[model samples]
Target: MNIRPMEYVNRERINRSKQLIFLEPEQKIQDISMRSGFEHPSYFCTVFKRLEGMTPEQFKKSHGFGI
Candidate 1:
């Protein structure tokens, strides 16, 4: 499986986002998004929803985060 550089970066970003969500679930979604290298919170939410099948807030809540 040959992965392009951009694809690898994107994958890493998404993985990082997931880890951050678990690590700091109480943090604001926008903060997490930006920390994960997403330029805009909305874009992050869109991509996250598309890839994870739920919004970041939903994911957090599902994981037992109060947010």
Candidate 2:
């Protein structure tokens, strides 16, 4: 399957963010977004929602993180 480079990168970022959410429950969403290589937290949330069907914060809550 062919994927756009941006799409692949966003997917990877989202995956990394997911791991961070699970492993670093105390980390802030902004920090996680930066650690995941997103320059801006707003864009990170946008891409995350597009790929995961939820914002990072929502994902964290749904996954029982930062509760």
Candidate 3:
């Protein structure tokens, strides 16, 4: 792959998190981060916002999965 190893991991982590976002709409970001293989929720949110253009909370709300 052309991407760096960390980049690949980050993308995979984000992808996994996205699935959880839809599957567990009511789940908290911290829990979602943990379930998605992230060691820290804050880092997960940071990457999520960077890639998706919105925080996980925002993404969830935007998709009608959260309040």
All candidates' TM-scores?
0.84, 0.92, 0.92
User: Clash pairs of candidate 2?
Assistant: none
What is candidate 2's lDDT per residue for 1-67, written digit by digit as tens?
4999988888998899999899998999999999999999999999999988988888988988764
Off by over 4 Å in 2: none
> Relative to the true structure, how large is the alpha-carbon lDDT of every model?
0.87, 0.90, 0.89
Give the per-residue lDDT digits (tens) of candidate 1, residues 10-65.
Answer: 66787899999899887899999999999999988887887789998998889889
- Deviation of model 3 at 9, angstroms: 0.7
Model 3 vs. true fold: TM? 0.92
Give the 10-residue window scoring lowest on summed lDDT in candidate 3: 58-67
The predicted structure with the larger TM-score, 2 or 3, is 2
Worst 10 residues of 1 by lDDT: 6-15
Model 3 spans with C-alpha error above 4 angstroms: none
TM-score of model 2 vs. true structure = 0.92
For every model in order, what is the number of clashing pairs? Answer: 0, 0, 0
List clashing residue pairs in candidate 3.
none
Which scores greater on lDDT, model 2 or model 3?
2
Model 2 Cα shift for residue 5 (angstroms): 1.0
* Residue 6 alpha-carbon offset, candidate 1, angstroms: 4.0
